[model samples]
Target: MAGVTAAVSARLKADEARRPGFYAAGSGPLPQVRGSTLPVMELALQITLIVTSVLVVLLVLLHVQRRILLTMTGLASALRNSG
Candidate 1:
């Protein structure tokens, strides 16, 4: 095993000295790139939030209107009974 290791090391050293430009040495491989859909994801989230906020506001306004109508009806009844 040690003899095989020595042979491989010697071979590698000889190869490295002989052909320095064999494996595209200095420039390296072209860079790989990947893109994410973060902007689309954020836009979707913002749209959802705006829609939910508008729905909540509409529901709150509906509740307030219902309460106001009830109060007005009660006041009208009280006035009719007193008069």
Candidate 2:
């Protein structure tokens, strides 16, 4: 089994080396700087949070307005009955 694995690995190495523009560096490729992506993603998340908060505030305001209107109408009818 080990011999078969070794043969397969050798074949893969040979095939990879034959490809165009292939160069083997000692330290390999440089590490990607993903620091920029973090801030951009954070900004997007913040914007979404702000928009969601605004919508929630608007919904609460509308609900309060509806309740106030119902209460005022009830009060007006009671006054009319008493008068």
Candidate 3:
């Protein structure tokens, strides 16, 4: 109902007002690092993630059929052993 929505909105507003940091516009508190270390660390993490994702995609593409066959064989072996 509209009344419930209004109450929820009011509660959220009060909560936000009570915690300014919680609704901060910028990235939450920066780590205690010297000079540009923080940005460098963040960039490193981003690059690592991108490279990892690309490698994973390439690996999957290169072994799609082999992976599928191995998965099915493993599943069948598991089922057979379970009986």
Candidate 4:
């Protein structure tokens, strides 16, 4: 069984070797960068967070303003009707 597996593996490797090398890197796992991070990705995420926060704040303000307006109008009509 081991011999069959090794033969198959060798044949596959040989076939791969004969093919045009279109791939740039080796067929193994990429090197890990434990302490490193992409600066551009971080900047983009931060900007997105800031924009999302601003949009949320604006939406909340608009919602609260509309509610307040509705309440005030209702109160004014009630006061006029009562007095």
Candidate scoring better on TM-score of 2 and 3:
2
Which stretches in model 2 have alpha-carbon errors above 4 Å?
1-35
Quantify all predictions' global Cα lDDT against the true fold: 0.80, 0.81, 0.79, 0.81
Q: What TM-score does each of the candidates earn?
A: 0.56, 0.54, 0.38, 0.53
Q: After superposition, how far is residue 59 of candidate 1 from its true place, in Å?
A: 0.8
lDDT of 1 by residue, 1-83 (tens): 99999898777766765774343234466334356566679999999999999999999999999999999999999999999
Decreasing TM-score order of the candidates: 1, 2, 4, 3
lDDT of model number 2: 0.81
- Model 3, residue 27: distance off in Å is 16
Worst 10 residues of 2 by lDDT: 21-30
Per-residue lDDT over 55-82 for candidate 4, one digit per residue giving the tens place of the 0 to 100 score: 9999999999999999999999999999
User: Deviation in angstroms for 31 in model 3?
Assistant: 10
Q: What tens digits encode model 2's per-residue C-alpha lDDT throughout 1-83?
A: 99999898777767656774443343377445655586789999999999999999999999999999999999999999999
Candidate 4 runs further than 4 Å off: 1-37
lDDT of 3 by residue, 3-42 (tens): 9998987777678657733552344664454565668889
Q: Give stretches of model 3 more than 4 Å off.
A: 1-34, 65-83
Model 4 CA lDDT for position 5: 100
